[model samples]
Target: MMRSSPFLRGTALAVSLVLSAPAMAGGYAKSPPAQQSNEESRHRTLTNSPSYVPIAALTATVQANHRARGLLQIEAGLEVPDAQLRRRVERYMPRLRNAWVTALSVYAGVNYRYGDIPDADRIAEVLQEATDMTLGEEGAQILIGMIIIHGD
Candidate 1:
């Protein structure tokens, strides 16, 4: 039963670090951390495909009993079969999003209720019309992901 000297403990720690360094270096030398992350992210982005464009957080004011209660958040995506149309969709996303926000707001104001489920078919219809109207053609298809109503 004895205490190790400062020199002994320091030497032991240094030796352990020196022994572990090669293994750690080899592990990372295979692929740098940042590059690995970028590769993984690129793989995911590819798997999702350029055809599917995500539309996130389309919210509308939910008014109940003559007062604002909460908000109705709609999440959706567009599936365009044509790569050219997909590029156009991305280019016109700002205008398309504006049109959708207006349409969705109106739909939420008219159709949605405090304790009722949002009609998926009707919402999709609304979004499709908005898309077609904004894009001035028929190509991209609206795919609804979530219709969540946050209540107060």
Candidate 2:
């Protein structure tokens, strides 16, 4: 039988250990190199910049156990593509508010509790739908700046 030299055995073990170690660098990037500020992102939505129409804050009652549990407050803006569309929306403001309030009230009754605002995306989608229905097509969007639900 041949005996292996200690130096050779030690060299083999070292090589194996080095090869088995984890790599220190280089796979895939985990995220983007640059990130936008929230304000910048908000200002840069797809709608035209000068066409935001403000909606008054709306208060709707949410009930539980036949008692008023909370007030849901939503403040939003409509984004239209041009001054003409903006005027059309403004001319029909009463109808739009009525539709928005009704939509929000139904949403609050269905999906929210005393102190929770439903998902932002869900709210945005509902608002967009309401706008589309009111305007007879999909030409405008709703930009919801704040939504708050607080216990009574």
Candidate 3:
């Protein structure tokens, strides 16, 4: 019978320990519980938690981005004929929409936090200018189909 090298034995033991540790610890039992039903769990967590706010805001922003993306897709479908142009437009659409929505959402959320609507509008105007410059006229027009212009 061949003798195993000390180094190999040590490596094998280490690997064994790592592989078996979780099983020995009662794997499933160590895991967290499943979330409760929607209605029952609705008020269980703190509403004002910073961690929760960002997640909720991110979700809402993502939804808004999806809407913007849909609008862009529609516009691209109407405007572009060739497959290559359509594909390129589709690929860029999500990034454009997400950037715009995230900027708008952040501005609005910060303004709401401070109870300052006018300032938020001003900031939004600046954001819009930036977006328009970045996106150009055609891109701006596509985005406009999704977002409502509040003032002018």
Candidate 4:
């Protein structure tokens, strides 16, 4: 049996960690979670708590010219800090999903392209508008997760 050197084992471990680390730009990564500051940890906890309401992945077909091109998908959720507001958001999850679908359809049709990077700000604004319209207030903070386009 061949025993690996300590340096090789350490290097291997580090390479695996680096590969597993999440990319901080343009995509969501879940590495260094423990390194997050206290406030960040609290915020993360809050989002995963009862106050954080999860939304199923919102998807729409990317359309251009006169046919379907690809699928645009985004994962998101609502963070309602107030307990009462959280209850309301939970109750309205279905309505919120519907609104998000409608808004995403519009955005995909007008703003997104099949091969280009997605415009996250515009998408967030669209989702936020839908949220405001459906909830009739601005208590729920929209927490957008991953935004990606699947090419046909």
Q: Give the clashing pairs for model 1.
A: none
List, residue by residue over 36-135, the lDDT tens digit for candidate 2: 3543454433345688777777667888877888888887788787778888999999998888889888878886665554687887887788888998
Rank order by TM-score, top first? 1, 4, 2, 3
Per-residue C-alpha lDDT of model 1 across residues 20-100, encoded as one tens digit per residue: 999989876787778878966642221276688877568888887888888888878889999999999999999999999
For model 2, the stretches where C-alpha displacement exceeds 4 angstroms are 1-48, 115-117
Positional deviation of residue 133's Cα in model 3 after best superposition, in angstroms: 4.8
Question: Candidate 4 at residue 132, lDDT?
Answer: 91
What tens digits encode model 3's per-residue C-alpha lDDT throughout 1-152? 99999999999999999999989888655445544355345433333432221111111221232232111111111233345544554556655556555655655444432222234344445445544554443333221212222321
| Candidate 3 lowest-lDDT run of ten | 69-78
User: Candidate 4 — which residues are off by over 4 angstroms?
Assistant: 1-47
List model 4 lDDT by residue over 66-109, tens digit each.
88988998988787889987888888888989999999999998
TM-score of candidate 3 to 2 decimals: 0.26
Clash pairs for candidate 3 = none
Q: Pick the candidate with the highest TM-score.
A: 1
**TM per candidate:** 0.68, 0.64, 0.26, 0.66
Candidate models: Cα lDDT each: 0.85, 0.77, 0.41, 0.83
Off by over 4 Å in 3: 1-91, 113-127, 136-139, 142-152
